[model samples]
Target: MHHEAFVTATFKNLKPNDVEFRMSRSSPGRYALHEFMKNVYDLKVTDGNGNALDVSRPDPYSWKVNHHDGTIKVSYILFGNMGDGTYSQIDETHAHLNMPATFMYMPNLQNQGIEVTFNVRDDLKWKVATQLKHVDGNTYYAKDLQYFMDSPTEISNYSVRSFDVDGQTINFVLHHNGTEAELDAYFEKVKKIVLQEQKVYGELPSYDYGTYTFLACYVLNASGDGMEHRNSTIITSTTSLANGGMDGNIGTVAHEFFHCWNVERIRPQSLEPFKFDQVNMSGELWFAEGFTSYFDDLSLCRAGLISQEAYIKGLIGTFNYVWNSPGRQFFNPIEMSYQAPFVDAARSVDPVNRVNTFVSYYSYGSMLGLALDLSLRENGLNLDDFMKMMWTRFGKHEQPYTVTDLHNTLNAYAGKDFGDYFFNHYIYKNEMPDMKRLLNNVGVSLTQDQNNVSFGATIVHGIISQNTIMGSSAYKAGLDNGDKIIKIGDTVINDSVDVNSIWNTYQPNDQVPIVFERFGKTQETTVVLQASNVYNLSLFETNNLALDKKKQKMRDAWLQTKK
Candidate 1:
């Protein structure tokens, strides 16, 4: 339907003859350029006395009112349809507003206090929910533009669930077509995640207003995402709580909540003062986002909401993804993190060779986190203590930390030698730790399926879906992305053909003739089958071996609940 939010920015007491009102090009919790100005239209500037004023655009995102009365009311229509953490959406069902996407503000008045009153749709029985301080009616107050922009609002006929933990209130507001029973069930697990994450840092961040809100819009029209703020987070998805969303979307809730401690308070120096007018890139995203990703599922396991098998299985994806990546040959963790501006939800029409050139900071850092945690456990310590130390020295004091601070802190907590080795080899050099030995300390065995045949390209309907991995069998055969194999040896590849079954008939080091389509031309080549590079992770007892007391105790201590 027609999705739009009418905004009226009333600016008064102008210090000079002109005022610049701008729509933010960036938002918090993300590292991409959104250019929110594109969605704003029908802009009309007028005086407080209801007289039209002269407005000029000096830049694409800014509107300058020159030689005008001090009082100016800038009104515009913000057309938003994508309901996620970074954008806004308004419809007859609800008005989900992420601040930067819905509001315009005076450039010089960032430090000035602000108040907004949401004129809700009484016909739909809509109400306002936000992290901003409630004034009266449907109005709210923010200390400054920074706080104002950070506070996202949801207006709908939503349900609320609240609980007090450590004298701080946690609110869960759900906008969905689900039953109250479903909400109650979901909130119960949310409580477990909250308490378990709290156990990690030994406490919660002192929320600015003694409350933290989870603004969740699970309507069919919403997009899927989770973004963390100082005292709140916005989690939107198209999946309803009754439709497998309870299991699927809970991970995002856990992930965003952890950020209140890690990225939000345990501040990264590069993102200390978040920029609104430009893209913000930080080299510590490997630690900022990746480490939080590690804790997201780990928290679920520690809370007993998920089984140990599922938790261990979760490690396989990030582990193989990070370890198998060829991007490490070029960029270290810090350098890989610098790619956030290009990869963090950045939009482009051109094709990119990301498969071979890039590794996600999320997966890269998460595997590193797994490695560091296991390594720390080997030294009779744990990652939890290191995080706690981080909170005490940096987060609690609100001192923004750099990469060196992280290294020095690890050195102080683990040891000079241990920290130096982790940083020099793993962090700075893009090398991986001995994860196999570290995981084996807890009775999990890591092995490679080298005896099996390997074809390192994903094929769907006789077409290669992605770029072939370097050094893989397909790559050795000169196969690249978009090559459609018509026949491999005697097996004709098609929609009905199973590539795996064909590969099963072959042995490692076997060579076969292949015919494929490339750029509208048929080609012939001989492909040499290589040893499978697949890595398998299994528990010692799963392989019919009993864990020793030492390893069993270590596993229990690592996975068990703190309290």
Candidate 2:
């Protein structure tokens, strides 16, 4: 055994029998910094003389460092499990192993690189897969230690398939299992969409580009996440074959992959030189995530995977979300993006006020992206040219931009003073943005139909005041803080409700009569079910216009078609 800060171990004993090792923890957060949690254990089984033998780290539940020892055997647990809260679950028995702790960095030191290798028991049934490169046999190599640490839970279960894209191999590591045929079909669809995105972006310049998909069972209950790196991106979701269709899945892949150009390469000021120890904020998160999120869905639409109506419906969903959020008033996208680390903590209670007051850079940022795109389009400069200019000016430099730098860079690209408007409307004010005027030039119109009045209400698990979003359709419909939805149409809701079964039964612009009660008074209201968060618009629901326009603009830009 070698005693070191990283906790490396060498096994001297050798045995032919099977052995299992358990670590006190499975993440770096629980251990000392400067040490990767996955590297905390190593085993090499030898004869009585301690010669050479094979070693392996098998299974997701625990890292089993294996080797052939003599009559005796020796193994140590590499990392301990952080427990079951933050991770997702495939079944009741198996949960997605999240390694948030692994993102911990050593104080005041830059990590040039780190290596984590894993080998499993040959006969083990547990499937082994990751975003890392697969070496021969059971071994795998995580290329960038900083990135691996940034997203330790970035890996997924072994229920996905592997395919090739543009001479580079690709793998879809999923949290949920689908049949081999099903997975193969999905991978093919994803490959085609990604290839199309690469063509639009000119070329896939990075030496490596990786993709990961997480299947969330309850379509809306799960959220989507994406972060870019030099050669890969960590995308987390509950998206599956069942909920998101070909367009949704492939579009998500393209969006994150495109970040290799937009966000990953020509990055914002705060995100470029990422401070591992603190919250990294940039007023430009809207460009980073919003633009990416907008493109993710739009790329597919441009590829003809979805119709114009479907695309519009999706945008409407996102707009409704953004328009209805009270949090937008509390914190602007810039502050929210900067305070992501603390705001994401469990203590964040108010929908608006976080443990740290922060908004999702993706959600609010995307809204700004929509506004920016429309502005560009109106001025006779399309997003494609803007993207090319940004790439040429900022992306080629391969460096981060500060707030002033972001404004100056955009000004240089657009040849105008564009920062003030974005700052005034998105960063400071809470007035409803006039999206109709923006989309007019692009031939899209926004309007309200009181006859098809949506009242823009949404449902919740309970009638708890805190659970009800302040500006949602439910709140706008005069539903009291403690009112409960006992029934939707003819269906009685119990044990949590099925929003889909109730909503999907109607058509767009269809009216649905809903009943809820408060203070012993049962009231019935006929709500015109305008386009809601439905599969008719795709499985995912959003509330950002920039995200919507970004999607549409990305589609148009990728296809080189005029709106």
Candidate 3:
């Protein structure tokens, strides 16, 4: 049987399943992005002998080609009785690809293959860029199936820029509507942070650690946020660029870029093989997203983008964000990532309840990461050493690392039962982390009081548990992780609620009555707030000012900074 391939993709005003196609084979294949385009994309084929062959929808997601002499009918159901919004083909103003037929892979009888590229429409609102080599006009080449699968070239009207950071080529793209200066500043600052991070690890990885940022402007309404990929990240927020905006997004960029070392390379076993068709579930997301979260602000501070005070403030922010959520009682980081599909879907339906049930792999993960680092320090090791060991053993690998790989490598690096230390808290336990104690060991104190019944515990939040402080008291109060604490006693809660709130209000010896809630469960507690032994963010500061400076010096050294 002679095998040949010819491919063409087009869109019409008609619904997706209405188009037609003629083929020389009994079956042809197709691939589509269901997330962006949802419809019954139908296809039919005929042989050269003028015979209509049997075509089965074995894989609805995959395209099929069939042998035929007559035209093969290929179409899909776009809009039903419900109107297809104004964003239809020809009628749409922007040049967004109606269908994601960007990369087509054709394999020979020998099991080898070639990738075919599509010429995306060039308009002012759109700019096309990809890792694929440009063959000529509208055509590009992918080295293999992997590249073809990963490459999504059409970044419609999203922010974009190209930069070279410390001889490492980098790209920064913002939402087109965002201010150019803002993006430029972010790129410059983050590049510096990446460079500083690399210096500590010794050598840099490959020069082509390509990075891109996509801002959705209004992600899922005003609920804009960001997520990371191997070489790119998607960030969206309502903060306009023209209004001198987007200070919050800076930490996000730092967090995502750092993933190049963690999840992208030095990853866990479950995450080694990415199952794009279904779920890429992992129990080690705490290590990936959590540690990345801890280091995100640290990287910024090390690069001098933020002051030490600001760095601690950032950590406090994470503490508050995580502690206020109520999901700790229902789920942990590992379980959350594993049940991501259901959890994410549930979030879309009932966001409040979702947070109550599901914990964030990133937030709790980072907390665990800090705990692990402190534990290592307690055991005579440090995070820097772990980072270097990870880089030397796993990160330098040409292929992806697995959970087993990460575990084995970490065990080898630490030379002990590090697994139990990590998995117990981050994966298995629904218990609160000893963040206050851990911070104290590192010379920072975490203190809290609601009423006469006062206690110190690591506080975190749940998705459905909104409105309150984050950390020990917040966690024990059965509150959601991202709760916004409104009022305490007679005072209204502002941006943050923690020991500092108590400090700013009542004197050290003053007894105060506190009222707070979890998922709107209002409770009252009376307790005497204690004067901090350590500075805020410092778990173990001295009773005097001079000793605090000495501890600060040590903290500076830990951050590899000049005192």
Candidate 4:
């Protein structure tokens, strides 16, 4: 599968100086610098008279024209063969395009309008799905470069479904290997999620084009990603609906759809006017991305797509991961949000100490959202009300908000002193929230494994140590990262032997002989197995007769859909 894109732009008015045209270095939803200009080649520039214009190759990314008439015509052939939410791909099957990776823009004329025309093969029966307004047969119009770059187009012979909500159209464009029955069943769940999220904010923000398109590709050759736009979202995955069921793909849809209200409109001020050349970092992703993740699964439970027990298990898993991570001792939620440029889709060959020093803002922020929601519920206010207030103040107006704006809004809802204290401790300081206490307040029990014997560190593949919690048995015994465990208690450690089985043979405070390899040398040490203090939280049965009446009432209200 191979293809080429013939793109042309006409410059009407220009001064007698060098005009620069270049591809984007970074995209909106992606935090890393992707150097998209590397895939473009076969560039040619000419004046209106069809004479060759003098073009200069100043850098690897840009082309400069010095001697051009008032009208300049630039044409280029883009070679794209990979697909995701942030990159462009073209093949015999379809053409998946992310605009920043496909189009070239002048830095000076970024404020001007853009018109793009796609010349599709007549025999292929291809149709376009995007947020850009249609002008005619194959041409689309964008008011400015930002809007053009934010839109992604999918051209294929795919399955499409549409449903009306609040007098607006919600289109689901699917390109997958699946049956029509499976597709219909999957979309039913999607419709429920959309409606449930809308109930949280009390309403959906007005769409830019009176419609929202979910451009989804669940193909065998595609990578997984979900990126949000103004009126649409790009969702791609290697999992098929027929084989993996709706569970594999619906989470991404739930997350990206919620972003339409969170990050797309109630945006971080730093990311309001997205830059295509450099990484855009913001401190509010804990709310933007994190809070959305928290609600995505909750929305599933509320919509009856998932059971309440499944929801509680999911919450337990999230709480365990975030609370036990050693990175929490070093970075707060806001501090972790600043690490996106290095972690979010950014690649590196050399390994670093990310395990010991980094916790994903997604998980951390989700935990923060959960704790805050439960805490606020005890105070007679809920996160749903807080989100509605935010939507009313910022999202309704398409206003870009800052950290201060969030603090002010939260202060108004949850007292001035409490808001300041919450922000300082949870967002600014590297302190873990009291999840045990907070959960108990809502009639849930948070318990720890007190009698089980185990080394405290997380073992990767039963070989390498990843993160050893401070003062735990693993850290006290001098186990560190990159150390390979060769044997435990004279039993040779292998892939077949379960590590936990060996630990379970002994009780807490028992001495166990350990052998490990580090830095090309084998060493012997004595590990005293201790009871793990890390809270492995699980939701107690809500039907228990011993539960307090008031606390059960609080839990019931917390789980129900907000009016």
> Which parts of model 2 have CA positions greater than 4 angstroms off?
1-113, 125-176, 208-229, 234-248, 272-277, 342-359, 418-433, 451-480, 483-563
Distance (Å) between predicted and true CA of 149, model 1?
1.2
Error of 2 at 1 (Å): 27
lDDT value, residue 372 of candidate 2: 74
Lowest lDDT 10-residue stretch of candidate 4 = 536-545
Off by over 4 Å in 1: none
Candidate 2 lDDT over 164-219, as tens digits, reads 55556555665544456666677676666666666555555544434433222212
- 3 versus 4: better TM-score goes to: 4
TM-score of each: 0.98, 0.62, 0.66, 0.95
In model 4, the runs with Cα more than 4 Å from the true position are: 3-6, 456-462, 465-472, 542-545
| RMSD in angstroms between candidate 2 and the native structure over all alpha carbons | 10.6
Which 10-residue window in model 2 sums to the lowest lDDT? 26-35
Superposition error at 428 for model 2 (Å): 5.8
Ranking by TM-score: 1, 4, 3, 2
Model 1 C-alpha lDDT per residue in residues 1-563, reported as the tens digit of each score: 59978888898888657779999999998898999999999999888788998878899999887866678888999999988999999999899999998999887999989999999999999999999999999999999988999999999999999999999999999999999999999999999999999999999999988999999999899999999999999999999989989998999999999999999999899996889998767889999999999999999988888887778877887778788887888899999999998988888998887888899999899888989999999989999999999999999978999999999999999999999999999988988878789999999989998778888899999999998988788888899999999999998887888889999999999999999999999999898998877678878888887899999999998988779
Better of 1 and 4 by lDDT: 1
lDDT score, candidate 4: 0.85
Number of colliding residue pairs in model 2: 26
Segments of candidate 3 deviating more than 4 angstroms: 1-126, 154-167, 178-183, 207-225, 244-246, 320-326, 329-332, 345-353, 378-380, 402-404, 417-433, 452-550, 560-563
C-alpha lDDT of residue 521 in model 2: 87
lDDT of 4 by residue, 504-537 (tens): 7888999988899988999988988888665654
The digit string of per-residue lDDT tens for model 3 on 1-563 reads: 01111234331232223222221110000111123223223333344334555655444344444443334433333321111111112112222121222212222211233334543436444555554556776676655544444443433465666666545666665543555676676667766766766765665566333434332332222324444444544444555544534456567667767766776667666653443344455666677667888788777778887776566656775676566566677666667666544543222444444434666677777766777777676566777677777887877674556556666666787774775556554556766657765565556656554333322332333122343323334344544444444455566664454644444655555655556564566766654544433323533433232336644555655554422
Give per-model CA RMSD.
Answer: 1.2, 10.6, 9.6, 2.1
lDDT of each: 0.91, 0.51, 0.50, 0.85
